[model samples]
Target chain A: MTDKQRENLKNRIAVVAAWGVALIFFFPIFWMVLTSFKTEGQAIAVPPLLVFEPTLENYIEIQERTNYVKFAWNSVITSFGGTAVALLIAIPSAYAMAFNPTHRTKDILMWMLSTKMLPAVGVLMPIYFLAQKAGLFDTKLVLVIIYAMVNLPIVMLILFNYFREIPKEILEASRMDGTSTYNEIRQIVMPLAWGGIASTALLSIILCWNEAFWSIVLTTTEASTLTAFVASFQAPEGLFWAKVSAVSTLACAPIVIFGWLAQKQLVQGLTFGAVK
Target chain B: MNRTLVRLLQAPSIILLLLWMIVPLSMTLYFSTIRYNLLYPEREGFIGLENYRFFWTDAAFFPALMNTLVLVGSVLIITVVLGLAISVLIDRPFRGRGIVRVMLISPFFIMPTVSALVWKNMMMDPTTGLFAAMWNAMGWQPIEWLQDMPLFSIILMVSWQWTPFAILIFMTSLQSQDQEQKEAATLDGAGFWSQFYNLTLPHMARPISIVILIQMIFHLSIFAEIFVTTSGGPGVQSTNLTYLIYIQSQQAFDVGVASAGGVFAIILANIVAIFLIRAVGKTLTV
Candidate 1:
């Protein structure tokens, strides 16, 4: 056999092995989605049924029983709402930092990041007490505000990096034409940096959606996101297998789809350009 | 834009972050020094270091601390090692590799509570679980994972979620590697193992540390998984610092001691954060 045959054979082996690893890594999720389609009894079958009559009974049952829509709506609202708020606050902040650098700019950026380092557990009590006092506890607005704050630093950083990528000449030229700051942002910055902002928003939304620590601890039923909703399954029973799987599937599907779409850009957003 | 206008644009974020950082944190410090309870809000007074001492001396403190260390340490090792191996396996061009990468990274996007519950109910449940069925198929008894090894169970769940993160980071780093050198090495009779040890490992050094540090900051405070799967117990076996603090604040309703626990957590996290921030700081430009 020639060397080409040997190399092609090796590549085939690698692809097969890679597929095996991928399947193993992905099995639990595949199992969860599969179980979501199973009836409760089928979900917990003695041998864990691989081939069964698929059903939407579990999904229907979850919605009827727990109003899964409410929790999912809350998740949707908070994730999108939080991203909107973070972007509103971060866009200008990042815009300034990107265009108008000073000696303190890096220090200011570092200081903002240091805020992220403050452990959430450390700050949970005060926030909890304060929220209760302010009558904001377990409200979607509170979740939105808190999520915005928690993700503000990274969102700003990602935007800052993206904003910096827009050539300084365009903004300066706009300034010379007497375009106001607001218009400059709305016209020059937003249009030019649309891709970055979208990805940053995607990144922020994903973070807010999967934020278990705050969502789990800070909220109960009225404001509970899907993370909190699923935590209700903590002490679940065998009967809950299909329901929990259904809820879990619904909870993660949107973000996972969004993540796969944003998969390429998220690396730079997540690492804050550090990995490159 | 004038500097003043620029400052105005920047003010909201800086101020928001400032208040976010300082307000609750200072309150936590104050709460730690005082005697306070949620149930007895009317009776509060400065107790100096008593709350700290009480929190430190709690029966579960040492075990929770050890559990925190073990959980973080073991998860890091598992994710990093497995992540390296998996990334290398999938590194060479393969058919449908994009889909493979997407599948592998899907777990990272799953919320912790969901992942934990799925693992607990469908994957780890002794009799009705997938693992049990597999165990039975092989003629063995299924271990009660969350019951018998709660900490390990939590570690496994977290590693499953985070290994994708490590893989993603490593894969991006691997893309930039000098393939010409690899080909040169290959022609020089260098085997895959030697190439990996010398080329890939050295190339991945920076990203590996970034993975470890970032994962450390995250794993140190893992809560939802333990909360959902084990509730930090079958005993206090799976309880970590964050859960211990959660119990103190939410369950035990001991605000003073919980604040102290929070302070301990803050201190512990900052020790890691100082290093991580320095690493992240390098990327910032004025």
Candidate 2:
């Protein structure tokens, strides 16, 4: 083959390989989506059908049997609620630490991170008992608070990294202009760091949305999120593969789309800026 | 400029985190040393390390510890190795790269419970699952995944969900790499493997460590997958320490023993945490 033809061949091979790898990585999700459209019998059939008449029966049955919308709504409210509170608590402190660093700042940040490292189960019983005693068990409010606390260290660290990137001269110039710290933040820092703040919120929201452990432990039915709702299908006797797949697809769809959009921020935020 | 104002701005977060950390943890520590079974509240009293002794002596404790380590270790190795290969493969631009990236990263967004259930019933079920179907198509008996190799099964599901994370981080780090060095190495007649070893691997050290540490923290407490799929069962074969503690407190209603197990988990986590904090701390300062 000529050199030009060999180059073309190599590019084609790369394209094919990339597609093959992507497809394999994506196969389980595709299978779940496909299974969601299959009839119950086809869903669990030996030599599962790749070419079957698609049906909406599973979706319809799931809707009739359980309040899928309710669980989804709870997920939305708690995740957003948690992200908002986390940002509110995290931003100011992050700003202070980033711009007005003290000798103890690093220690304090490390301490906060250590708190996150404390395994959740270590505190599970007390939190559970306390929630019951306070009559706050299985409430969205409690979940929101716990989620915020759970995500606070991450939010603060990411926001701190973002705020640190804002050129110091901008803040210094404002200070020389006799602008107050509050005005400095409101007028300049917030606007400049807006993208980072937004990304922090998005990342935390996704984390909260997919958080399973605390949600399953803390909420039984009244305030169950999509994670807990999906776990409810763990009943071993049921042959409701299609219905479960439908619920699984529904539970993961919105966040997966959101995750794709926020992939860049997710990398930066999740690694605590270690990668970037 | 008053430093008090800066301290004030930071105090709310500090105080809240302090309370959140101190209250429950101290309570857990307190409970660990005493007898506090929910089923026998009247029998509650200071037991002085007896709960810890009971937890340590249990046959499942050592297995659970081993399982936790194996699960974390296997997943770490799988994700890092695969992530490195895939990141390098896609590092050079290819057709439809954006869509390919999305496809690759989709699994990380899946809820653990959903992923577990999907793997258990739809994919791994030997009777009529996808793997079974594939095996039967090829005229082979399907491997019973959860029944025979429960821990490995859980490891596989968790690894699938997290490999995307490692890929994302490694891919991002690769974008910021020094291309001149790679070009120079190529000019020096170094092959792809040599270039990767001398140029890419060293450059990716920080990200690789970050991925391993972060994934370790999450994997150490893996619960929902076990809860949904194996229930850490077939006689504690798949039981990690986290699941064991869940069984102790939630099922057996022995809060004291569970708390003791929790303390053990705390220590295990701290051993990892100290190293992570130091590594990350160095990065932050620099």
CA lDDT of each candidate? 0.88, 0.91
Q: How many clashes in candidate 1?
A: 0
CAPRI quality band, candidate 2: medium
Per-residue lDDT for B1-286 in model 2, tens only? 4789898899989999999999999999999998899899899789899999999999999999999999999999999999998888788876689998999999999999999999999889989888888888889989999999999999999989999998889989999999998999878889778999988999998889889999998899999999999999889999999999999999999999999999999999999898888877886851
Q: Chain B, model 1, TM-score against the native? A: 0.97
Candidate 2 segments whose C-alpha is farther than 4 A from its true place: A1-14
Candidate 2 backbone collisions, by pair: none
Per-model TM-score on C-alpha atoms: 0.97, 0.97
Error of 1 at B72 (Å): 0.4
Each prediction's DockQ? 0.82, 0.75
lDDT tens digits, residue span B53-106, model 1: 999999999999999999999999999999998888788865698999999889
Superposition TM-score, candidate 2 onto the true structure: 0.97
State the TM-score, rounded to 2 decimals, of chain A in model 1.
0.95
The superposed Cα distance between candidate 1 and the true structure at residue B145, in angstroms, equals: 1.0
Candidate 2 local lDDT, A1-276, one digit each (tens): 996797688768777887888898899999999999999888877678899999999899888888998999999999999999999999989998998898899899989988999999888899999999999899998899999999999899889889989999988888999998779889999999999999899999999999998899999989999999999889887758999999999889989998998989998778766667
Kindly give the stretch of ten consecutive residues in candidate 2 chain A with the minimal lDDT sum: A267-276
